[model samples]
Target chain A: MMEEHKVIVELKQIATRFGDNIVHEKLDLKILEGERVALVGGSGTGKSVLLSEIAMLREPDSGEIELFGEPITQMSGRELLAQRQKIGMMFQQGALFSSLTVLENIMLPIREHQHISGSLLKDLAMLKLRLTGLPEHAAHLYPQSLSGGMLKRAAVSRALALDPPLLLLDEPTAGLDPAGAAAFDDMLLELHAALNLTLILVTHDLDSIWTVTNQVAFLGERRVLMKQPIEKMVKDTHPVIEAYFANERAKRAIRQELI
Target chain B: MNEEKQPPVISESSDGVQLRGEWTTPYLKQLQKISKNNTRHQVNHIAIAQLDPNGSRVLLELIGNEPSAWPEGLTKEQRGLLELVREKVGPVPAQQESVNLLAALGQQVFRVIRHGRELLEFAGQLSALVFSLIRHPRQLKIKMLLDVLQRDGLNAVPIIALLAFLLGAVIAFQGGLQLATYGANIFVVELISLIMLRELAPLICAIIVAGRSGSAFAAQLATMQMNQEVLALKSLGQDPFAWLVLPKLLGLMIVMPLLTVLSMLTGIGGGMFVAMVQLDLSPVEFIQRFGAVVDPIHFWVGLIKAPVFALIIVNVGCMQGLLAKGGAEAVGHRTTRSVVQSIFLVIIVDALFSILFAQLGW
Candidate 1:
């Protein structure tokens, strides 16, 4: 079992509901500072829900979610928003507003949080855009003008505008080509190492599990399947673990190795 | 067979990944159940809104199986009484009474003499937006103008013409009917022809444009409000009122009078058709009388009121659209509200104009 006392994000029995449907049960979760945790699960297994819940878009019905020891559930809208400004989230759809220019989109959060001159704001926007490896010239173009891979990269740049300490990315490599996804993973690793940013990634990509993360949290049927380092996680015996790894695709690959 | 019954196929077909067919079967059944319920619920909702309880009960008997349609129950009744009413009313005939020789004779006279006072209202209200955009124009420039003119001018022409023509015909018909009671049918031609030129045709045309384009602008703006695109601008630290509402109001104000004039022409033209064919009136005699009936003030009066109509259309429509809530649905609601309110206001303003014009006795 992994040690859990040094927690940056701590949820003590969090419960959240949508109308009457329970999205999250009395789920207890924690992520330490600098921890690279991969939240893995089946479809509709509350992986994204838990991530967004901590992001504070949807409030928990009962129990508390703490960020850097500050209780999130108790914060007011302005305070909650201030707390959110400290955390960066790359959404599943790269939820960049469709109408804004790339530069305007990046500058939106920065200008909102800080009062600065237009030239200084432009410089800041250009720096963030360059960090994501996009051309500075692309800043003037609209979101509809970009390709899917470019969109995610642009979204990542926007998410990092205020240089938030923690980054919560949902399906970072979901729709990328293998080469693009690999490059993205490397970029993420570089950003994480450079910024000392805590990355809590939610994904189902088995390749990402082997390639990217240091630790893993398996959210299965109702509770955590295993919360440990990746190497140890594969060795552990859990039904979800067995089912995830024991697919015919793995067996077929092994059989094809003989050919 | 039992192995097949166990779902999650992951078949090695042409496609790399596949779930069992049965996996989708249950989901489909749920979808079908949902759609059926939705159809039923939508029908019911629309039925409830449009039809009397007696009529709604008759519709409920035809399609009411809840869970089979949809769960949240999409609105049912939008297809309400329109369908039933259409069935009951049968095939509508072309408007025959729209044309007559007396109306034709009257329209020729009304055109030169018309008091187009509505144009002034359009002028004052339209300039506000033009002045604002002159300071800081964006992608909103030509598109807003084209949209306003196309809707106000082009689409409104036929309806306005039809209304003017029909009004001229009605004046001739009604005046002729009364005068015939006293064996004064010849005087009916003079009375209808005189009224058509001096006041009726231009007034009717202005009213039609006011209702059509005015309400259209209101509804359009109201829908914008509902979409929250306007709110999104404010969150980005942009003023939606300056960026959206003002320019549109100005566009409508500038564009409405030209369209209103076109509507009057069409209404009078429609009247001319009736007058020429039904009243045995010559176009030459109609023009001679029309020239005699209308003075410059009569035509100017109708044109003067158009700016007011345009102003109301833009401000009111935009306000309603801006007030829209929730999402696209709210946009639709406010759109209806804007159109209804704009048309009513246009009529009220026209009525006030009538009272003022009558008081001046020009």
Candidate 2:
């Protein structure tokens, strides 16, 4: 089933630089449709930067990126809009527009791309809010008033507003409590199953990487060191990958999994 | 697929009206148009050719958000999506129109009162911090104060000088016209010196500082507050006002008087130039007349207002910053309020000062 799936996002020979510092060099990644992939690395590994590059929020210094088979670097802004509509990105800080209520934030992207009646738009936005497990009252509240977990959910709802085929999350469960994080992971799984969404998440949480994702893309040396199931990748003896999973947090997650 | 153009169709079927084809967000308008003609509220059987979240939502809307009427032929995903929309979708609360005049007035009054209370509270706290710091002057952050002084004071010199010069020139040209007519051309010297020194110079300088440094302080502090740096300071057992507000207040207070003096000199120079050109008064004669008639007390009065204006501007800015809630938008809003409130208070205080000066025979 995985072999038959089409590539949703493709990056080849990507490079990112900030002045004299090279963040990424010759980085390559391919995300297939319906696959739950986690981009995991230590801080400064540029996971968020890589996620943004794939989301088309930021352009890599040098790379060829294709979304849904079309090379985005060569695509016109109009063409890119069509491709961009198929991808949704949630930032680490829950970058929901603080000025807008949660429901309005969800409605904005759909309203921009699709001409639906105001009632239908509201219903759709509400459905998105529900799908993310946010309370109905949360729909009317501004992003500022939301708790950390609710804010993340609101951000996810906004990301899912257009029902994008590909969902990208940057640390979706980072600030959430253990139960909230677990519930969020479950919601992601359910959404992925129901919507047939190709999920690419940048996460530091080992539990999220273990439970929410099917494949782990370990980023090290400014590139993906290995890409495989978490079960297999964890066992791999690659020194950088070993060093990453050797942390106390990773051990706790692994221990929990065994039980 | 060419199926993209095939909008959802409603057909009369044995299971009641069957809504078929893609009912996604993009095709919603077309679906609504067709459904409206067909009385889509009767759509009970959802024969899904394709369905997404938006499609499911539109389907629910067509069925009046009643999942009980939904047919059993749907797949688990389709059924789940449809039920999800039906179960969770709530009535969009009507946007509250702020049309009631009395309510609006009441709200405005409450806002002003609340603002005043917060300002008083902040002022009290600030004074307490000042008194405590005064007792331990060695604990003051001199480096931060000097940094703010350089930024808010020295960096503003060129713009202040240019504006003050132009202000003086305009005053001299306007006043010199009437003076020249009445054969009191030399009186332009007194007019320019008195207005520039006693009223316009300090007022204009305060307004400029309010626009520039006042807004900057509000924005910087608001961002810090939003980013939890203010809380972090408190967590570290440091008063945010001592760290953030004091340096700014001291800097502005030190700067405003010096800037006003600069403005006064430039204003007088501008008036001299205008007197030379417009009133046929030479620079030497104008200076001599300025020396003879321009009361030094007017200059003192203007200089005395600077620190007061500075205090009001900095307090308003810091208060707005600390009071800022929400995110980036609140920072912008607070900064605007800082500048506007600073200018308004400065003007009101200036007017009060004018009355006080007049009554005191200053």
Model 2 C-alpha lDDT versus the unseen true structure: 0.86
Report DockQ per prediction, comma-separated.
0.02, 0.55
Interface RMSD of each: 29.2, 2.5
* CAPRI accuracy category, model 1: incorrect
As for model 1, its CA RMSD to the true structure in angstroms is: 26.6
Q: Estimate, for each residue in A27-134, the C-alpha lDDT of model 1 and write its tens digit.
A: 788788777889987876788888887787766788888997788767788877767876889998788877788878988987887655465456556656766777
Model 2 preserves the real interface contacts to a fraction of 0.62
Error of 1 at B11 (Å): 70
Provide the lDDT at B23 for model 2. 70
Candidate 2 lDDT over B15-34, as tens digits, reads 67777777766686776677
Give the number of the best model, judged by DockQ: 2
Candidate 2 to native Cα RMSD, angstroms:
3.3
